[model samples]
Target chain A: MPAIQVTNLHKNFQTKRKAVGLRGSLRSLVRAEYGTVEAVRGLSFAMDPGELLGFIGPNGAGKSTTIKILTGILFPSSGQATVLGFVPWKQRRQLAYQIGTVFGQRPQLWYHLPAIDTFSLFGKIFELDDRETSKRIAFLAEAFDIADLLETPVRKLSLGQRMRCEVAASLLHKPRLLLLDEPSIGLDVVAKQRIRDAIREMASLEGVGVLLTSHDAGDLEALCKRVIIINHGQIVYQDKVSALKRTFLTSKLVEVRYARQVAPDFHIAGTETLKVAKERYGVKLRFEARQTPVEAVMARLSEVGSVVDITISDPPLEEVIAAIYEQAERSEAAIAK
Target chain B: MNEYHPTRTPAWILLIMRELKFLLAVWKTNIASAMEYRAAFIAQMLGMILNNAVYFIFWVIFFDRFRDVRGWELSDMFLVFGVAASAFGLAAFLFGNAFYLSEIIARGRLDYYLSLPRPILLHTVASRSISSGLGDFTYGILSYLASGYCTWDGFGRFLCGVVLACMAFTSFMIIVHSLTFWLGNAAGFAGLALNAMVTFALYPVTLFEGFSKLILFTIVPAALMGALPAEFVRAFSWGALGKLFLGALLLLGLAVLVFHRGLRRYESGSAIQVEV
Candidate 1:
């Protein structure tokens, strides 16, 4: 049986709404308006124990909502979900003992205290006795490379350092399943790599299942084996990371600022210029990696002029998901015909 | 079925005992966090004491002008102030989040507690410390001592009264803040309710009558937190103890009920961005 089994899970939220202007405000004061939002709709999936699964999506996608529901912090509006054979929302506390979580935007560490204080508190909370707690803390400190930084207050730590501590703290009890929501949201490249390396090593060493969520496709590639991409409360794509790369992750978005402008219609073969700034000094372009080589593009770029700055990145997850959705609809139509 | 180990089915009492240890650890962390700047912690605690002292001085001047109001003398005022201050102080000191729990709920900070293996209500409230409240707690004991009512019996009564009042205050705040589950962002509403309770609780319940008195006893619960407890302290009556116990029990029950009921609708702000 799967470690997690979610079938036809749905969650809806009701949010109060008021219009602009005094008249709208006054009307709302007398009679309020509310609208329903489907935060997660008919989401169904299952994961094997110790699997490295990435739940990736853009902001406002259902990734975080689904993770929250799986952790038992959220009750689905309808349908069912079981994590480790326990109904999550119904047996939240029980389920919590087996699962660790890190919500990127939320700091579980006490900001004004040293990271060690929180680690100790979590030890007591998780029911590990003093000696075992200390031993576990020391081991985690070494694994996450956070030993030297434990004595300093959390607030004084860099974002990267703090996040390392945060992740380490979550693992203190050796939960079987780790639910991480955007754990690398704001880390620099070096920091992100460090976190990804440590997480991968831990998951392998502990045989821990990771249902990791992120907005960046890079995280999925770096740490996850299988990938599920969701958007607007629904899954748009799901497959092995290799399959996803070939089908949906092939395109790249490049933004460049040149030292000088040469021509208005400056172009490169095998690449589509999505936007050229009005001043002609900056440009945005896209090219399929299978079709255009990066070295060729760079050679052409150098031929044009000295470059000031350049960034190569994945297209927004929203854009990728939208494309997948459109392709799915077209394929369905063709099959019907 | 999944292959994970069945969750440990600890006895209920065992669960409570573990959670209490968790609570103590959290409280210790809160104080340690507050004491990070030792001088600031001292300043805040002392400032609160001085502030409470100045507020009490007004009563001194009042008694100087006129001796008593309806068998309410300066000493009785001391007992009442002692109970109310200590109750509010204890609630503020230990469960500091109770004062602004609505903000935490509204902002979806409760996710931190909900994800943990502890009782949600206890862990959330005890997460922070209002160091200044330490000063209020000290002033309360001092005030009770100065009331000339600090006999062993009086001290026991004072302790009882303060514990019940503290529970009432904390429970009341929890119930108000839990309304945010249904009503969007009830922070301002909770703040207003807290102010009403605190304001009325500081005054003598005998000062009001009839419908207003009914409101105080049932709705705002200011009389229950203040005057009733003070009366119980002045002279122990089974009737007074029953009333105090009953009031605290009712409020605590309602608080747990309302908060857990509201937990069903906790958005965690994850749904906010998904709004239509």
Candidate 2:
């Protein structure tokens, strides 16, 4: 059975209108006005056991709202959701024991106390036996390589160290599923890499399903087996991470500077000249990696001039997602037309 | 998805015990955290004691000049402060977050408690500590002693009053704080209401009568938190003790009901990622 199943979920919020001045405030005290906002519009998705799925979206795209509903923190306006075959909102307390959550921006640790203290307290909260709690903490500390930092107060730990502790603490209960919202946010590259590795290992070793939300493309490419992108409260794209790259990651960006002036008519087959700076004697090219090999492209560039410098890189995940969003908009406009 | 299957829910007794155990563990962490800064901890406790002492001195002078107010002696005032302060102190020290519920709800800090497995309301209240409350509790003990009502029976009554008073005060604040879930940001208003409760509770019950007295014993319940407890300590009466106990229970039940109802409208704030 799938670890999580959400069907046509909808969430609407009513926010009060802010009064402008003293008169308006006094008037509002008598009778206030409100406006309804649709945070999640008919969203539907499911996740299988041991699957690493990336739930990505831009700001205000309902990513957090959807997670909140699935975690039983917020009720859906209309629809059905079950985590581990139990209705999330109805069986919140029961479901909480089976699922672990790590909000990168929110630390669950007691700031003035060591991470071990919070871990011990969590044992009581989850009703774990002392022996089991200690064993699990030790295992998690070793798994996340945080044993040395366990005694350090949360306020004294570095951001990366703290994040490691946060994720480790969440896993102390041996939950069957993990819901991570921006778990690698605000961490350095090395820290990000370590977290991704730990999560990947946990999913593989324990068969724990993970639903990770992140804006970092590297996180998706490195950890997630599947990717789901949302925009304006609806799913824009959903598929294997590899399949997404094979389909949308069509072009490779190349920037080059020449030793001398280049011709205005500079062009190559299966390649597009994005820009030609005459004053700087430089040119930028974009081409399908399949159509034009990197070696062949560089060989061609060298023929044109004594290449002073060259750089090649695949299009970033943001740009790829943006292109997908553009395609979606165009299709939507066409349907409207 | 599979059909709804009924798993054996734990017995209510066991669940309550687990919740209590979790609360005690949280309190341990809070106390340890508070003690991390030894000097600051000492200062906050001592500072509250000194502050409460000033109020006692003011009452001493007032009673010295006028002798008594409406058949109420200075000893009665001490009893009032003793009961109120001890109750306030015990509630604040143990369930400190109750006093800050409005701010927590307004700022969306409930996310932490909501995500945990424990009972959300109790967990949120027990997870914090008010260091200065220790001083208030000490002052309460001293005041009760100074009233010269230090007999064994009197001490037992004082302890009972403390429990009832704390329950009334905590539940009252919870009711006021729950307003933030519906009113968006009611922190300032909640603080004002709490200040008003404390201000009126410190005065003699003889000063109020008719509708004012009824309102105090019912809606605002300053009498329930203070006058009733003080009256029980001063002159033990079964009727008054029953009312104080019953009032505390009713207010607590009402507060819990109101808070859960308001949770339906809670719109989480976005600025709750930082440490509390």
lDDT of 2 by residue, B1-276 (tens): 889978876799786776778888989988998898999989999999999999789999999999988988889988889988888888889999999998888877888888888778888888789999988988898898888767788889999999999999999999999988877777888899898788889988888889999989887888877889988997789998999999999999999999999887777755735543
Estimate the overall C-alpha local distance difference test score of candidate 1: 0.88
TM-score of chain B of 2: 0.93
Flag regions of model 1 displaced more than 4 Å.
A249-337, B1-13, B270-276
lDDT of 1 by residue, B1-276 (tens): 878887876799886777778889988888898899899999999999999999999999998888987767899888888988899889999999888778778878788888998889988888878989889888898899998887899899999999999999999999998898888778889989998998899786668899999899888999877899998998899999999999999999999999999988888874221000
Writing each residue's lDDT as its tens digit, candidate 1 over A1-337 gives: 7999999999998877899999999999999998999989899889999999999876788888899999988889999999999999999999999999998888888888889999998998898999999999999999999999999988889989988998999999999999999999889999999999999999999999999999877788799999887776877788998787567778899888999875778799989988888684898899988899988888887788899999998776456656776776687579899
Tell me how each candidate scores on DockQ against the true complex.
0.36, 0.56
Candidate 1's TM-score reads 0.87
Task: State TM-scores per candidate.
Answer: 0.87, 0.93
Interface RMSDs of the predictions, in order, are: 6.6, 1.6
Q: How accurate is candidate 2 locally (lDDT)?
A: 0.88
Total clashing pairs for each candidate: 0, 0
